[model samples]
Target: MTVQSIAGPRFSWRGPSNGWRQREGRGPTLALALFILVFSLIPVGRLIVAAFEGGFGAFWQVLDAPDVWRATRNTLVVAFGSGSLALLIGVVFALILSVTTLRARTALAFIMVMSLMIAPQISALAFKTLAGPASPLLKLVGLAPAPGTPNPMLGEFGIIVVMGLHHAPLVAITLASGLASIPRPLIEAARLDGASPWQVVNRIMLPLLRPFLLSAALLAFVAGTGNFGIPALLGLPVGYVTLPTLLFRKLASFGPATIGDAAAISVLIALIAGTGVIAASLLLARSASRLETDHRIEPFWELGRWRPAVEAGVWGVIALTVLLPLASLLATSLVPAYGVRLSPSSLTLAQYVEVLFRQDLTVRAFRNSMLLAGGAALSLAVITLVSAYVLDRAKPKVKAFAFALIELPYAVPGIVLAIACILLFIKPLPLIGVSIYATPWIILFAYHARFFAIALKPVMAAMATLDDAVQEAAVCDGARLGQRLRHIVLPLVFPAVFAGMLMVFLLAFNELTVSALLWSAGTETLGVALLSLEDSGLGAEAAAVAVTATLLVLVLMLAMQMLARRLPPNALPWQALAGPDRERRG
Candidate 1:
C-alpha cells in the first residue's frame, strides 16, 4: 500500500511526526532538567558550601593531629580488611554453588539473600553475644578470661568480622549472577580438551567473571568505608574509631568547630566513594565490551563418589557463615542471661516479653520506623518513576545528563547524604518554613536521597525493555498521553514499580547510619532505639528488638519475591534463564 493511502490521504507527514517527537523528547527532557536541578544540584551545592566556608580551614588545621591520623588509619584498615575477607568468601561460595551439584542450591540462595537482609547492627550484636567476654559460649569453652579482662571480639577484629559478614551476601549474589551468565559450553569444551577442573575454573570462569567480581568488591569497599553501625557497636566499646564514627562523634559533640570538621570529613568520604564508583563503572564497561558472547549449554556433571563429601562441605560452609550467627542471636534473645549456660533451665521468653510489653520505647520506635519507611517508600517511588520515565523518553542531548544525575547517589554514602541534608535543611528556605532536624520528615528525605538511585535502576531497566511500538499504536488509535500512560504503561511497568518500592522500603526500615544522625529524641527509629538500649546495658531488650526488626525485614523481602514471581515472564531473571520454554509461555 502507498504511504498516503495507508496513513490516510488527509494526514500530513511532517506535522504529526514533529509534534510527537517534541512531546516525547523535549517535554520529558525539560522536566528532567528541572528535577535534577532541584533535587540533586541544590543539596550538593549546600554540602559544598558547608565544606569550604569554615569547615575546610578547621579540617586542614587538624589534619596532622595524632587522633585524626589514628582514625584515618583505622578506617582504611577496617574497610580493606573486611572487603578482602568478603571477597574471598564470596568468590569461594559462588564457585561452589555455581559449578557443583549442590543439593541445597535453592535453600542456599534463600539463605544468602536472607543474610543480606539482616542488618549490620543485628549481626554485630549476635556476634557479641556469642563470643563476648560474658558470652555463655566463651565460658563453656573456658575462654572467658578474667572478669576485668578485655574482650577481643569488641575491638578492630570484631568490626572487620561483622562488616565482612554483613556485606558478604551482596558479594556472593553479584558474583553468582555473573557466574550464572557465563556460557556453560565454554567450560565443557575446556574440560573435553583435557583441562583440569582447577585449570578450567582459573582460565575460563575467573576471566569471564572479573568485571562483576571487581564491581562487587569495589561496591563492598565503599560500603565498608562508610559503615557506622558495626564500628560504633563493636569498635566504640574498645576505643576504636573509624571515619564515620568520628564524624558522628564530631557532630554530636557540643562544638561548632567539631561540626565543621565533620562536614569536611563527609565531603572527603563522598569524593572518595564517587571516584571509586566511576572507576568501577568505566572498568566494567571496558571489560564487558571486549567480551564475545558464547552460546553453548553443557550438561551438569555427576560428582560420583565424592558427591556426598562435597555436599556436606557446602552445607558446613553455609551453616558457619549464615546459620551460626543467626542461631546465636535467636538463642540469646530467648535466654535469660548470656553468661549462664544454655540448658533447658537457662531458656526463657521473659526478654521478648519485657521488651515488647514493658518498654514503651519499643512501641514508639516501631511506629517511627513504619512512618519513616512508608514515607520514604512512597516518595521514592514517585520521584524515581518520574525521573526514570523522563530519562527514558528525554531528548538525547539531556537524557544522558539526567540519567547521570539520578545515578550520582549510588556513589555517595548514606552518612554523607545525611550530613548534606542537615546542611541544606537547617536553614529554612522560603518555600519550606521549618528546620528538618528532629522531624520524621527529615529522615524520610534523607532516605529518599540515599536510596533514590537504587529505585531508579530497576525501573529504568524495566522501562528499557518495554516495546515503544505499543505506545505508538495506542496513540494512533486516538489515545491521549495521560490515557496511554494510565491504561498501558502503568500495567506493564507495575513489576518494576513494585520492585523499586520493595527495595526502598527494605532499606529505609533497616537503615542506621543516616537515621542515627538525623533521629531526634521523639523520632527514633527501631535501629536507633536498639542502639540506645545496647548503650544503656539493656542487652536482652536490645536483642529482642533486633530480632523483631529482622523478622519484619525478612517478611517484606519474601513478599517482594512473590510479587516478582507474579510479574510477566519476561520481567524475571529466572525466566530469562529458562530460555525457549519461557519465551513460548510469554
Candidate 2:
C-alpha cells in the first residue's frame, strides 16, 4: 500500500509488527487529544447538561411550546424540500458532466461550486435584491414588484428555493466522486446490448449509484437542517422561523435566562442532524458490498446532436444560480439609493466607496473576519498535523471515537455550536475570571469547534497514502518522534496541511452562522456586519459589501485553481472536473 508522490519525495510504507502503541514520543499526541476534547467534546457536553439542568420537565415544556412545534415542522419541510431540489439538480449535472459530452463543463462546475462558497446570508441577500421592490435588475426589466411590495424572497418558499440551489453543488460533488468509481465496462456492455442512454442509466447506472444519491440527499438534509444564514435573513423578516433562527431569536430577546430552553431547542436540532448522518453512513456501508475495488472508468455517454442544447441548459442554470443573483447584487450596489433602478443616468459606485472607506464598522468587520479566520486556519494547521498522526496510528475503535468527536460539532448546525459555546462560556472562568461570551474570542472558540474536522480530514487522507515503512525506517535510524515528524512526516504531508489551511480560511472568512449569534456590537464579522446593514435599511450598502466579499472569495478560488495541478489528485474538489483525465474520458 505504498504511494510514491509524483512530484515530492517518495512515500513508502509497511505494516507495523507492533501494537497500536508506537515507540514514538506521546507528548504531542496526548496534547492534541486533550485539545480536541476541550474544543470538540466539552462544549457539546455542557450544552446537553444545561438542556436537562432544570429536569426533564424543562425539555418537555420546551418541546411542548407551540413555536417549537412550528419550527420543527418548518425545519423538516425545508430539509426535505431543499434536499430533494438539490438532489435533482446535482444528479443531473453530475451524470451529464461525468458521462456525456457536455461542453464547458469544467467552467460550469467551477461556477456551481462558487455558489457553495458564497455565504448563505450573502446568497439570500443577492436573491433578495433580485426580485424585491428594491431590485434594480428586476426594475430595469420591468419585472420589479411595486414600491410597497414585500420581498418575494422573505418566507418559507424563499428559504427552500435558496437552500436548494445553495446545496446543489454538494450533491453534485458527492455523486461525481461516486460516478468516477463506476467501471466503464459495465456501461459499455449495456450500451452494446442496444440500450439507449436513458435505458442504460435506468437499468445499469442508477442502481449502482443508489447509495451515492441517497448519501447526497442525506447530506443536503443535514446542511439545510442546521443552516442559519439562509433562514435568518429570509425567514426572520417574514415570521417564518426554523429551529436555528428560533433559538437565536429566543436567546436574543430573553438573554441568558432562556439558556435552558435554547439548549432544549438545540438538542432537537442535534437529533435531526445526527439521524441523517447516521443513516448516510449505514446506507453507504450497506452498499459497500456492491462496489468493486477496481476504479478504472471511461466516459460512457455521448449527446452528439443534443450536446448544444444540454450545454446551453447547463449554462442557463448557471446564469440563474450564480450570475443573475450576483448581477443583481452589483446592480443594487451601484444605485444611488435602495429600490432605485439602474440606468445610464442613475449608476454610481458611492455604496462601495462608502462601505470600503467611509464606514468604520464595515472596515472593522473586514479586519475582524480576517484576523479570526486567519488565526483559526494557522492554529488548526498545527493542531491537525498532530491530530491526524494520532488518528492514523490509533487502534480502530479509538480512532473511530476520535473521528466522531472531531466531526460532531461540525455535523450539528452552526447555530447549535454557537449555543454550545454560549452555554459553556456565559460565566467567568474559574481561575481567569473573564467572560468571553460577548467577545471575538467566543466566536473564535466556536470556529475551532466547527472547523477542526475540516482541517483534520485532509491531513488524515494524505497520511493514509504514506507507507508506514518510511516512519519505521526513521525509527530504525535512531530518529526520535519529534525528529521523524520534522524530517519525514511533516514534509510528506505538508501539501495536505496547506490545502486544509486554505480551505478552512476560505470557509471561516465568509462564515455568518456562528458569529451571527455570538457577535456583540464591536465583535461584528463580515456576515454579521452585512446583515446588520441590511436590517437597518442600508440595503444598497449591504449589497456593496456582499459584492466586495464575493470578489475576495473569487480571487482565493482562482489561486486554488492555479495550485490544483501541483497538488495531489482530489486536493481541490473541482480538480476532477478540470483535469486532463476528464477531457480524455470525454
Candidate 3:
C-alpha cells in the first residue's frame, strides 16, 4: 500500500527504485547559482568597493559638503510629499473603482495605466510646454502669461507635482490588488447591521486597508527617492537638486574623476531605497493577517442619483491626467520651432521628419535602444526559465534567498545600478584587457541586472500552476532533465515566458536613468537622445522624439491587450482589471 501510494498509477515519485532519481544532477542548479551571483551579486559588491575605495575619505568629503546635505533634504521632502499626495489620490480612486457602480470604469482604469507609462521626463516636459507663455494650448485659450515670465515648472514644486501624478496610478493598482482579497461577507454583514455606507467604509474597510496604503506610500517614497528624470528635467535648471540629479551632474561635469564621490552618492540612494523596502516588508508582514481571506468582495455601492456626476468626474480626471498633456505635447512637436504658435499656418512635420529620417544621431539612438532592449529581453527569458525551474526544485530557504537576489537589483534605483556597473567594469578585465565602460555593453549589463525580477515574475507564476505529475511520468520513462524541460516545462510556460520578455523590452527600451550615465557618443539611447535635445534647447525636436516614443509604448500595450486572451491569468500587469470590468458590466 505504501509503495502504491508513493508511486501513483500515472506517475512515480523520485525514489531509489526509479532510475529517474539517479539521472538528476547538480549541473542545472550550479549553473543557475552562478548566473544569479554574476548578474545580481557582483555588481552590488563592486558598488560597495567603489564607495569605500579611498577608505572613509570619500565619505568624509561627501558628509562635509553643504550641497550634499541640501540635496538630501530635498530628496526626503520630495519623497514624503509626493508619497502623501499619491496615497490620497490612489486611495480615493481605488475605493471608487473597486466598490462603486461607476460607469466607464474600464476606460478610467485604462487611462490611469497609460498615465503611469508616460515616462517621468515626458510628463515634466509636457507640463512645462503646457504652462509656458509660448504654450500653444495656453495661448490659444488666452491664458498665456507675459513672454518674460519665469517658467513655473522649473523648480521643486513642479518635481513634486509630476512625481505625485506619475505614481498615483501605481499606488492605485497596488491598493486595488489588496482590496480584491477582502471577503464580500464582511462588508455585507456590516451593511445588514444598518450601518451607513460611509460608516461601513470608515469603521471596517479603512482598518483592513491600512497595510496596503502603507505599502503604497512606501513604494511611492522609494520611487521618488530614486527618480532621476523628473528632477533632472524640472529641478536642475532652477538649481533645485535631488540626490539623483546631483549624482548625474557630478558624473557629467567631472566624468571619471569623480567616481569615488559619485559612488558615495549612489550609496546614499541605495540606503534610502533599502530602508523603504525593508519598512514596506515589515508593514506587509504585520498586516499579513488581513490578506488571509480568499473570497473577493463584490462591488456593492449603488451611486443612485450621483452616478452621472461621478462618471463625469472620473472621465474628467482621466482627460486631465493623460489626454490633455499628451495632446499639448503633440501640438508642440508639430510646430516649426520652440515657442512657435501651433496653427495650420505654422504646423509642420519638419521636426518629426528630421528626427526620424535626417538626424543620424537620433536614428542611431533608436537603433541602439532597440538592440539593447531586445537583446536583454531575449537573453533574460532563456535565463529566467532555467532559473525558475531550479528554484522550483530547491528547498524553501534556498528559494527565498534566490528570489531576494532577483528582486534586489530591481528595487535599487537605476542610477545606482549604473554606478555599480561602472565600478565593476571601469577597470580593464584581467584576462580580456578591455573595459566595458563608455560602451553599450555596460548599458546591456545594467538592463540585465535591473530587469531580472521583471523577467522572472511571469515565469514563476506559470511554474506555480504547472502539473508535476507529467514531469514525473516522463522521468519514469527514462527521460533526461533536458528532455523533460524541452518537451514538458517549456511548452507549459511559454506564454508566460514570452509575456515577461515583452514586458522587459517595453521597460528597458524607454529607460533613461541606467543609460544616462553609461551612454557615449556612439551609444546613445532614445531616452538619452531626447534629454540631450531638450538640454540643448531644441524643445520642439525633443517633443517630437518624446511623442514618437510614447506612441511606440502605446502600440506595444495594444499588442499585449490583443494577446491577453491567450496568456495566463494575471500575466500582463493590466489584466487584473478585466475582472472589475466584467463585474461592472454585469
Model 3 stretches astray by more than 4 angstroms: 1-23, 577-582
The lDDT of each candidate is 0.72, 0.84, 0.83
* Strongest candidate by lDDT: 2
Better of 1 and 2 by TM-score: 2
lDDT of 2 by residue, 1-586 (tens): 4333332232222234142244554676677779778988899999999998889997889899899999999999999999999999999888877777666667777888889988999999999999777789999999887788888788988999999999999998888767776777777788888998889778878888899899999999999999988998899887899999899899889988888889999998999999999888677666654564466455557777887788788788889888999999999999988788899999999998899888998999989999999999999998898888877866667787888888888888889899899989999977999998898999998988899989888788888878776776666567777787888989998878888888888899989989988999888899989988988989999999999989988888787777665566766777664333655422
Candidate 1 wrong stretches, greater than 4 Å = 1-21, 24-31, 54-59, 136-149, 180-185, 255-257, 292-302, 337-340, 394-401, 567-586
Instruction: Kindly report which residue stretches of model 2 are placed more than 4 angstroms away from their true locations once superposed.
Output: 1-22, 467-470, 576-580
Q: Which candidate leads in TM-score?
A: 3
Worst 10 residues of 1 by lDDT: 577-586
User: How many steric overlaps are in each model, in order?
Assistant: 0, 5, 0
Tell me the TM-score of each prediction against the true structure.
0.88, 0.94, 0.94
Could you give me the TM-score of model 1 versus the true structure? 0.88
Give the CA lDDT, 0 to 100, for residue 157 in model 2: 88
